[model samples]
Target chain A: MTVAIQLGIIVGYLLLALAIGLVAYRLTDRTAEDFYLASRTVGTIVLLFTTFATLLSAFTFFAGPNVAYEQGPEWVLVMGLMDGIIFAILWYVIGYKQWLLGRQYEYVTLGEMLGDRFASRRLRGLVAGVSLLWLFPYVMLQQVGAGTALQALTEGTVPYAVGAGLITAFMILYVVVAGFRGIAWTDTLQGAFMLVTTWIALVWVLAVVGGPSAASSALEAEAAHHLALGSDFYTVQWMLSTAITIGFGVAMFPQVNQRFFAAGSKKVLKRSFALWPLLCVLLFVPSFLLGAWARGLDVAIPEGENVLPVILAEYTPVWFAALVIAGAMAAMMSSSDSMLLSGSSYFTRDLYRPFVDTDLSARREDLLARIGVVGFATASFLASLWNPATLFELGDAAFSGFAQLALPVMVALYWRKTTRAGITAGILASQVFYLSSLFTSIVPSTYAGWTAGLVGMGLGLVVTVAVSLLTTPAPDERRAIYFDGLEAD
Target chain B: MSRPALWGWIAVAIGLSALTIPWFLWGDATLVAGVPLWLWWHVGWMGLASLVFWLFARRFWGLGIESDSDSSGGSPGSGSRVDAGGERR
Candidate 1:
């Protein structure tokens, strides 16, 4: 009976999500821009919540608590407070320029704007290629989270493969039918649900663990190391690097970049970002605290992603457990749909339309985007079923890859001397060094507190600047058109 | 939204990150309001971040007067087809 109830709750939530997609479909126009970009009509509340929910992915739902469970409360520093501030700044820094350029050129994808700016179709393709490469793992992270959450919630009755398959199928349909408008609406709902339920879970856990004072004392007695940042893993250098990489990565994620263009107005975008840190605190602090409290309660969590389920199932009521699991699944699905949409946009708009057929009609382009969505989701789902690595490891690798692009992007936007060759070289150097560090032992992933990704970013910056000085600048016409009205009055 | 003001916020963000995360300050055996001192310190900073971001957003973002540009090549002096705010003419 309990298992059935839990599964029913999850199914009900998924259905509600699909219904929103249908409503979005009815409202959507036939244009490719409407399908992929939601006609650029998203308001402040929807924009804030969609961006918020998309940013809080399965990794935050699963891996965040896992780290806190293993390390201590300091995990909050990495994703919660530090990340919150860093990302708010980045949104202002990177997103403002992106929005201006996107509006000026009526661009539907970042690649389109970038290619035009550099007068290099190859550079555009490279950006899309790099984004797709890293995005694959992140898309798979959601499948893994959904599959594991269902399997655990049903006590293995549903199975991991089935759980993952259900999410992928639903998300593909959702993205295909609803487009960006539906995504924003559903994300707002799911984001609010997850945030509220997480707080409720926190309060419930504090009560069950004999109150906040007792929980704190229990942790201090049992796991004092988790309380501080001096642990081997939480070295100053490691913390700084992790925060920097993830901050930059969040700003560069294609889905997030696209959201900058979805804002109905600049005021809407600014208001959303202004409130972002508060939302981060509300969502992340509770999850980390729940993890720390698990240590106090002596929960045995071999897999960190299982922290939420194991604790909720054991300590809380059956209904509460089911609701929380549904919320976690919501976080995973919301993130997955956005990634699928963005990845397909990159493939269809950036790669396919440009290289294969320059004259593809808007209707045909929409069809191709839907096809790309299915293809990409299937690939990611298959990868998730293989279960190659833990969520934390895969997420870290993917984030580092995106972080490497952040510097090049900033330079391309703000620096007029940035040449196509210099930007291309910068991206290549970063990827080569970063990818090599992952596979080989010649360089450690982290040494003296700096991550390979951070080192790669530094190298990429130096190479980019040097190559720019050595190469000829972009055409005077190109520079003038790109930067013409972008300056603040 | 002057260049120096923008740089100031960046400095504050980095400085706060450095001061908040290291073990020398809030990492010890202290608890406030039944939470670790470090955890509370972060909570405090989240508030500060909200304020700073709000101020930055109002003054700095999207301040340029909207201009019209054609879809053709984004070339300057082309006939205007849409304004800078991204709306169609």
Candidate 2:
């Protein structure tokens, strides 16, 4: 009976999400921007929540608590405190410039602006390709979260394969029916539910297992290491590198970049970012703490990502557990749908139209983008079947991949002297070094305490600067398109 | 310096320090509010970041005050007034 209630809530939530998509479809127009970016018409509240929901992926909802449950409360510093601030600054730095340039160029994708600025179509295609390589795994991370959650929630009755398939189908339907507008609305709804339920779960768990003071005392007595931050893994270097990689990686995410274009105005973007840290506080604090608290309550988390469901099922009531599970689903779906949408946009705009179908019309472009959404989601669904890695491991790999792009993209955006050759060389050097570390043993995963991704970013920056000085400059007209503003340092 | 530009640099300065400063050097034994001093220290910086970004947005980016008036027609290389500063006047 309890399982039935929980499954019913999840199905009902999915139906509600579908209904919102249908409504958004009715409101949507046939233009490319309308389909892809909500015609750049998102307002402040929706903008804020959608960005919030999208960034707070299943990694946070599931893996975060699991990390806390296994490692200690120190995960809070990595997941909550550092990321809140780091990502906020990144959004401020990256979003402001991207929004300004996006407005001026009517750019629907990051590649469009970067390519046009350098007058290099290959640069455009490379950016999209790099995004796809990293983003595919991240999308699979969401599928992995959903499947794991259902398998655990229903005690393996549903199975991971069924869970993955269900989410992919719903996400494809949502994006195809409503596009960007539907995504924004459903994200807002799901984002709110996620925040509220997370807090409720935290409070309920704390109350069930004794309050913070009692829980902390119990933790200290039984597992003192969980309360402290100087463990072998939580060293000064690892914490800082984790924060830096996740922070900068978040800024370069294509889905996040697209949000900058969708904002109705600078006010909407600014307001959203301004409140971002507080949002992080509300969500991450309770979520991670609950995971840590589970230790005091003697909850057995067989798998780290299963921490949320494990705790709620053992301690909380049936109906409340259902709501919290639904929220976790919301976190996964909200993130997954946006990623699918962004991936399709990248493929259609950067690769297909430019290379495959040079004369593709707006109508065909829209159709192709929708097809790309299904394709990307299907690929990720299959990828999730391997159950490749733990949620945190998958998220970390994806975050590191995107972080390497941050340096090149930042340099290209602000520095007019950044040539097409320079940016390309920087990205190539970064990816080669970074990938070599992950795949081979050419460089130790952590060399002299810095992560491979950080090393790649550092090398990429150096190579870009060196190559730009060596290469012929982009024409003055191309430079002016990106830099012709009244501000100077 | 423009109000926003000054705050922009300040934001970056604070941000770099928050990420770079060795908070983990603090001993894990000292707990504040049930969290280790090192963790609490980072939380303090998170609060500081929120304040810094709010200031940057209001004074530097001119968030609420600035609106994209020519959004529909402001394609780059065209004659629209939209520029990197994000101001029309």
Give the TM-scores of the predictions, in the order they appear: 0.93, 0.91
TM-score top scorer: 1
Docking class of 2: acceptable
| Residue A1, model 2, lDDT | 89
Off by over 4 Å in 1: A302-305, A474-477, A487-489, B1-3, B20-26, B62-89
**What local lDDT score does residue A225 receive in model 1, on the 0 to 100 scale?**
76
TM-score of chain A of 2: 0.97
lDDT by residue for model 1 over B4-85, one digit each (tens)?
A: 5446656876775665553566447577788877777777878877887776565544432223333332322123321234
Could you give me the TM-score of model 2 versus the true structure? 0.91
Per-residue lDDT tens digits of candidate 1, residues A1-489? 999889889889989998989999999988788887798878888988999898888889878887887788777878864468777777767776777667768887777887888888898899999999999989998898888878777878989999889889989989988888999899999999999999999999888878888888888788877765557877777887888888888888888878977877766766888888888888888998898778878777764347888899888998889998898889888888999999999999899988999999999998898889999999999999887478888889988899999898788777878888898999999988899899898767876669998999898898888898899965632765556666322
lDDT per residue, candidate 2, A347-417, as tens digits? Answer: 99998878888898988888888989989999989988976587777788888888888888888876878
lDDT of 2 at A298: 76
Candidate 1, residue B28: how far the Cα is off, in Å: 1.8
Worst 10 residues of 2 chain A by lDDT: A480-489
How much is the lDDT of residue B40 in candidate 2? 59
